[model samples]
Target: MVFRSPYPDVELPDVPLHELLFSDLGERADRVALVDGRTGASLTYGRLAGAVDRLAAALAERGVGKGDVVGILSPNTPYYAVAFHGILRAGATATTVNALYTADEIADQLSDAGAKMLFTVSALLPTAAPGAAGAGVTDVVVLDRADGYPDLAGLLGSTGPVPEVAIDPAEDVAVLPYSSGTTGRAKGVMLTHRNLVANIVQCAPLLEIGPDTRILAVLPFFHIYGMQVLMNNGLRVGATVVTMPRFDLPEFLRVMQDHRTDRVYIAPPLAVALAKHPLVDQYDLSGVRTVFSGAAPLDVDLAAAVARRLGCRVSQGYGMTEMSPVSHAIPDGRDDIPVGTVGVIAPNVECRFVDPATGEDVGVGERGELWCRGPNVMKGYLNNPDATAATLDAEGWLRTGDVAVIDDRGLVTIVDRVKELIKYKGYQVPPAELEALLLTHPGIADAAVVGVRDEEGEEVPKAFVVGQPGGSLDAEAVMAFVAERVAPHKKVRVVEFIDAIPKSAAGKILRKDLRAREAR
Candidate 1:
């Protein structure tokens, strides 16, 4: 059962990403490229291109090119785009770090990726500085002005020509955004220039975004969904992209109202808020023509309710960090497809439903693990062959580890998860990471972490602990212990003290048994 995309394949360009995105800019030189939602500042197409060229030249002057791995640790901003494209334009790999990561978490990623230089803002220097130092990197450029660090204004002051460097789009790695695939710690996903270019081209026909389109980019650009879909796609199509530094519901609504942005991209958590929040009624969201949710599953009823209230087309998509973030999406004109299902596969994609128990292909309407192969798939996990081999096969089919059922018409509905990675508010929270952190506490003798539904029906990490003899650690203490060490989204939400943790003969924590216990 090798299902294929129903749409015509898009012709992928062989040029570098910068060339694909920056060409023919003179025609729309004065048109707005990006808008700073908070400060109302903007960058016109001409100015953005000029700045990118200057930054690229400056980075090259610093001897960063070709095999160099540079890091960007900043929130969503117009300058974030400049720093990102500048890194790629200089013939270096850009690894975007999560803005909310702690210093140690930041250091771990920078060290693992072997990032030679880091670009950040003054706000994040508190973490970025230490992280870079810990990774033995000395060059850290702050995107915004700081007393002692190089700033974007200084970096882009160069009017010198960017050094000429040869690039093979198909073979050159462009960006490395880390992902916890199936089940493990974060590993860098090696997305080459061609992989990204192909994804943007593949999605264009389905999205129908254009020069007149205005997109609200409240989603962080570090994530693939925002990086490629919202930012890069909008730039390539000559659309106006408005950047938001962080997600504050009132501010988000205000920006949407102010910009009259027609296109909105969000995750499932925001969908819930848009459907049920009281603040949504105060703003005029009438200009929003399309609302596309991805990064996690969306509830059918919630999607319908939001559409009814906002008078917009609402849809959801299926993707992962490894698949250039999109394999299927409910196309804009497919009004008949249910919002709960990720509509037909993208152009140039082939999928399969494999029975995990028997390693056999499953037909339509049968639940099995979803596997997909496409031009947009990553080359492999960086420097981790074991993980790459486990996730991607010789035939190029990526084991998505998601239980899915496809209808005869090719709509995909993600029913359950075959992998252990938990999606907490659309963020991947690995149980193994939490379990390892829990084992470090002296008061905890044994621990197992699993995903449990909260009162609002969102998946949250819950820790089942076996306390040491005469230990005084309580639920709040345990929760606070991990909260201080991890990102806000990865914090433990619930804690339960148990006498013993069930395990298999090989001493593996039986997560299924714990899930069954929670069900009971």
Candidate 2:
């Protein structure tokens, strides 16, 4: 049985992403579109539009147009917006690289995306320069001044006519974001102009972003959640975007308080800090009205704690890189939907819950793998047809690989990854559930759960925990704490104290790394 979105289907715009976002800047000409929180600098909507055109013209004059793939490897700043839209406006696909990646990792993505040009900030030159060279990308532009590279000022100084290249919104690729999918090496996810535009429109109403809104963009623009949801969606709605070069808690609070940004986007890990950190009490975060967490599951108790501490509304959503990164979100004013649930299916999207064991669809309240189809779905993984076939079906449904359950009223809650579930004595154990419960303990600062082999070689849940500062949290105590609150099979069977948990820049616990430690 296929479940349809409760919201009315929104009109997916046929115009290219650049046009859909920038064509109507006349109304917001003097309004601030981008702000540099670190420097108190900003770009008006009118100035940003002009810079985009100039840079687009320069790229076109340099023979970069439709079908070309350009790469951006800079951290979040006001100019990251300039470089990104400029690439799309010039009719080239922009593959934004993670700023935290090493030289080799950066090269891998650039090579896989077949990027023709690269852009970076000077602070990242040590990695970006080598990565671009290793990827055989000779055309490099530094968004800030670098000795032997073109700079943003130079690129935007071009007086040449803007490129008149044609873009088929449905067919022309807009961005190439790489993802590891449910399991595998990261592969390029090809998102087209239409895919991007559809998502901006589909989410605008549900996200409640408008001209009067101000978005705190601490999340890196390289990630899809930050790219589409924060940057593109904020711009399409005429909201002011305040950027932080890197996430520092004191600085994040300072920016939020100083800039008076009301809407903040974050991952689950940051939600923990907001809920418990002492430094958060030092800032005037009262200006923040809504805190939307994504990229990974946010604990229900943690969400409530944050809401209580900050006096704000807290919500979370679910998506994978393959689904243009947003398939379900908690609508801003949805009082009927639980705050921790990912809410209803997005407009124009249809979903199916399939029991992976039998490859059959399941009904409401039953746990199953989620499959979604919508205009926001990606075209496919670039140059890897087998992986694409395994993920996307002929009918256009994407096998998300994450298990989920839908309530009778259409609210959806993510269970856990299909591959990450632990099987102990024929019962399934979800690590996310145990991890969330563990986080509620005051002695536990951070925690990750993974399946590990016990004395009899049975797969059991093991927790890697980061204890709170100046606290003595024992393994046996941790196990008892969880066992007392959870099902016998779901209780953590092992515990290891660690100083920190390994995580990606996007704030997802690196389970594979934890598993690797067990293997050793």
Candidate 3:
């Protein structure tokens, strides 16, 4: 059965970032496009375009050009957006790295993507410089503080208007967002200009964003959710993007009241803030019309409770980094779809649920592996054909290793993940990585990690450890051991002493049993 979008078909613009950011949106230049929440700094669309142009020209002079990969490692800030667009305007692929990544992680990503230049904040320079040097990066542009490296602000002022570079939007990769998808290690998800533009168009109808709209962009731009929805989508519609470097409930609520933000693009954890946090009652969130959550499964009950408190509509979407991060979004104000469903496929996207055991299409309403094929799908994983092949098939369908079911109305509901990846605060936390780290702990004899739901209704990693016979090891000590080594979100929250870790005959850890144990 062929499915069609209810929204009118819109032609995607075939242009580079320079053309899209500067040439296309004329006369609306003075409109406030970005607001820095921390410093109260703001940039109009015109000012932003000018900055991007100047920065692009400067980067070009520094030997950055088309097809070259540039790395941007910074938290969500105005500088991050400027550097990102500048990289794209120079016709180079921008690879976003997590600002919290360790030197080893940063070096691995920089080397894998062959990044020629790195744009990072001053505080991260100490970590980024060595990583860039280890990866043979030629240039480092520092944002905000310019004590040590080449000053980004000075370069932008010195450089002339950026020269236009002709580009094939369909063929040229614009953003390289990394993801592990369902299996293996992290690899760069190649999202072309068309992939991004198409996703924005598809998502626009659901968001109902416009020049009057003000979006709270607390979600990290390094992730696909913020990259496409908050940054790119906000730009496409000339909406105001209030950027926050990190998520703090009180600060976020204060900004919402101060800016009168109309829309919020968030992950599952933020829903918890709206639903249960005491700070929510202190501010006026009356201006907010919609709160859209994605990146992880949002409990239907929690979403409803949040919506009731904020007097806004709650919607959930399903996507992965490979899909330019949005495949399905529940249309605002629609109550027709089931509460837990991720809504129908977005405009111009095709999706199917196939049985993993049989490799055959599952009947509607039957749980199966969700597969997506569309312009929004990524080109491929950068430099890893094997991983790409495992994800994307010969027909170009990207197998999203999520077990889901499609209803008669074409709504999709994600029931489970086929992969053992844990999602903490919408970030992917691979169990294998945590398991490896756990084994190195002196107090632990053997360890297995699994995702368990917490009181706030978000997945948190829980570790079950078997201490050496007669060895003293408690839950607090084990949790502290993992917390020091990994990122905050990846830290093991709940630790349990087990006589033996559950495993299959094939030696694979039975995560389901662990999850069942949590239920008991």
Clashing pairs in 2: none
Tens digits of per-residue lDDT for model 2 on 1-520?
A: 9999989999887899989988988788889999999998999999999999999999998899988999999999999999999999999999989998899999999999999899998889999989999999999999989898889999888999999879999989999988843256888999999999998888976898899999999999998988999999999889999999888999999999999999999998899899989999999999999999998889888999999999999998888777778899999988667776888899999999999999999999999999999999999999999999999999999998889999999999999999999999999999899889999999988999999999998999999999989998899999999989988889898999998898877788889989989889
Which regions of candidate 1 are displaced past 4 Å? 180-182, 420-520
Higher-ranked by lDDT: 1 or 3: 1
lDDT for position 463 in model 1: 98
Indicate the residue-level lDDT of 236 in model 2: 89
TM-score of 1: 0.83
RMSD after CA superposition, every candidate = 10.1, 1.0, 9.7
Decreasing TM-score order of the candidates: 2, 1, 3
TM-score of 3: 0.81
Q: Backbone collision count in every prediction?
A: 0, 0, 0
* Model 1, span 477-503: residue lDDT tens: 999999999999989999999998865
